[model samples]
Target chain A: MKILSTLILLVALALGSAQAQKFITKSGNIRFFSSTPIEDILAHNRQVNSALDQQTGDFVFRVLMKSFQFEKALMQEHFNENYVESDKFPNATFTGKVTNIKDIDFAKNGVYNAIVEGDLTIKGVTKKISEKGTFEVKDGKVIGKSTFNVLVEDYGIKIPGAVAKNIAKSIQIDVDVNLEKLE
Target chain B: MKKKWLIIIGGLAAAGIVLALLVYFFVYNKPHKDYSKAKPDFEVEAIAFFEEFRTNAAASSARYNGKVIAITGQLSSVEVTDEQVVALFEIDEGMFGSEGVRCVLIPEKAETLISIPPGSTITIKGHCTGYNETDVILEHCSIAI
Candidate 1:
């Protein structure tokens, strides 16, 4: 009888906490860099839309392809027309969950290792990926950041043979976002 | 023979001048169209702009994507950082829910944006990157004249 009442109390507390566990960030930063022999090409998309369900560890990130700004206008034009083809593929997304949810405490402030496994889609192609990331709670806000690499060919992005030397096969990706509690 | 040689040299000089002029006009002195100085393609209300996308994303993107647009809307939030100033506008529920129209303003012109409070009406001009699933994002934004 005593164990049954304790279990019920724990369930009630979890339910209460779940209601306030959603976090959102409208301006997250997602950047990618490619370093090749001919040139080092990189772009930063500061308009990433992301949401996190803290109770369930569910995460989703979306960003417009045209939002990735380049230093050179010609490169930006080529990237839109030839490379990622922003007109055809408007956004890239990742929908997944933090796999190591049990180790992190939401109510407290700390840096915890998080492993995220999800479907990452780019250029209308989706791939299953698992990567290690970090979750840091500071000043009552959750900050999530991660770094990974993806090959251009992996996402069905074609690089022409002539300029292939200018682009690296693998591109490094970086993400940073400060999440606000969803009201 | 000497007269013919002089005429040939003179002709070569004239062709060189023309080539240089062409390079100056077409290559070196070409105009640079900055978004700050360029005219906006469209001026729209935030609600109406988002409504078009919500109704027909394909048509809206075809018309508005990759163009310089000016949008008027209420500021939902503002974020200032060392690098840039970001302004966010709400547009009801989007593909999933909770739609937003976000504008990233010019760093040099961020001073004019300080006085505007959240929920105040403002017009911003920028390059419309296009609508993602949840947000319509603009880059190189500035306070509209």
Candidate 2:
């Protein structure tokens, strides 16, 4: 009976440690900027959902396209109605892995550079992407941040000739998320 | 006679320019919708609303996305910050995490939000941003009195 109890305690400890390997944030922030000579457009979405698995190096982000708020209502309308078509494709997701997760020590309080490779889906189109970001481990929280440029045309978003000058061909995307331990 | 015609044309040109400026200001520089004052398109209980999404996400999203909705439920949790207050309504426990209606309240309601204890029933009105496979996001939320 003693040996059996010891085995059960060990199994419970293993499960507890496994749970500690996951971190998540439901209120992540994602911003996209499009700059042109005629106009500059920027939108922010604070309802991003992201998760990271320390053991597997798996990272995932889910962004609701409709949650993006723009300064100009017209821009937001056009972005949803004509650009990304939020009615048809309401969410954009990134499912990838941190290639260099081994180098980052989550137990230590410091910022570490990370490379993530994953499939990014936008407007129902999936594209493979590799981006560089930083993970800051502080106060038992992990803050992940990254900025990258995505070509508008790559996602099959066609700009009309009339408003082409108002929008940029490539948009700069910024991601910031503070993830807490699941337990 | 020619001078008179030119004056009329000039006056019309000036009026046209003024009209163009008005259109630009009203259409292009229009402000975002103030959800605090706007009436919700749908008033639903939090559990029913979440179940609709879980049962048929595509149809629920079509009906609710980008629309202002009022949801009443027991507050499961609250995360307060200087910028905003986020309140969660317990929906279900998924493999990844707990799924629910997550409302991001306007910064002005931070004080009121913090005072409310968890498990208290409340109604939140905001713009629904559809389900992210886990939580149905609501932004610019206000406590519906």
Candidate 3:
């Protein structure tokens, strides 16, 4: 009887472990673009790291405030010191949940639309936002993507009137992430 | 008399502009402690190096303009930005030889140093260049293993 009980316990443990495979990617890419008729500006930070908890549907992302790269060094410097103040506010983080984990299966290959809600902290300010994303699972890999808009004034970023119209008050963000399941 | 006063005011304004220009380019150009002034082959821990770098780049936390060396406690924290992937690692008690002189790996072949976990025992190899407020830069760093 003891041997049978031990065998049953081992099987349960194996099943539990198999159900808890999580996926994460720290080198995720996030980009922001703003353009006008006269000029077009682009910025991106590839160091955006993120993790997804498969068991609980929790997710987290982090990026160094100084990591956002621009086309020119002068523009990079201005973005950090003058605009982002990277030193004072070192990182931007997002903590959210990918709703409907049960509806999605990692073993199968298909596109699944998920609702994500979380607190996005940027420029030392935290805002609650709800966004939708399409996640594709194929060949033991998961790819997630989302596009959203954030208003600068809502985050207390001030632009001088001389160049205010040049920069859009609302900035659009695109996130494309590729994650590998952690064994 | 009015013309003379106007001339004096204009001269003062010109001087102010020149002063602002000088401070921005030259004076602000010089960071605090100026580790580039440090002698070659000097070694220090990662935390100490980041502290100095942060103080120097008070106006702007940008990339290192010179060489640096550091020892961190973890390897996973190493990252690259601005054509430089500054390595960040933690020093463990078992790590010997450097004697607590933890290291930060800057870009220059950072690709080889992948899959390093935190609190793991390992050795790092790199050229010490300069300090940024957050990292003690190793210009060209690779994993010793």
TM-scores for candidates 1 onward, in order: 0.83, 0.95, 0.62
Which pairs, if any, clash in model 1?
Answer: none
Return the number of clashes found in candidate 1: 0
lDDT of 3 at B47: 51
Candidate 2: segments with Cα more than 4 A from true spot: A1-7
Query: Ranking by DockQ, best first?
Result: 2, 1, 3
Q: Ten-residue segment with the worst summed lDDT in candidate 2 chain A?
A: A39-48
Using DockQ as the yardstick, the better of models 2 and 3 is 2
**lDDT (Cα, tens digit) per residue for candidate 3, span B3-115:** 99999999999999999999877643443332223343434445554555555644323343223332333454554443345445532222111112223343434565545
lDDT of 3: 0.62
Best by lDDT: 2
Report the Cα lDDT for residue A173, model 2: 99
Each model's chain A TM-score:
0.89, 0.97, 0.88
Candidate 2: CAPRI quality band: high
RMSD of 2: 1.6
- Error at A74, model 1, angstroms: 1.3
Interface RMSD of each: 3.6, 1.0, 10.3
State in Å the error of residue B129, model 3: 16
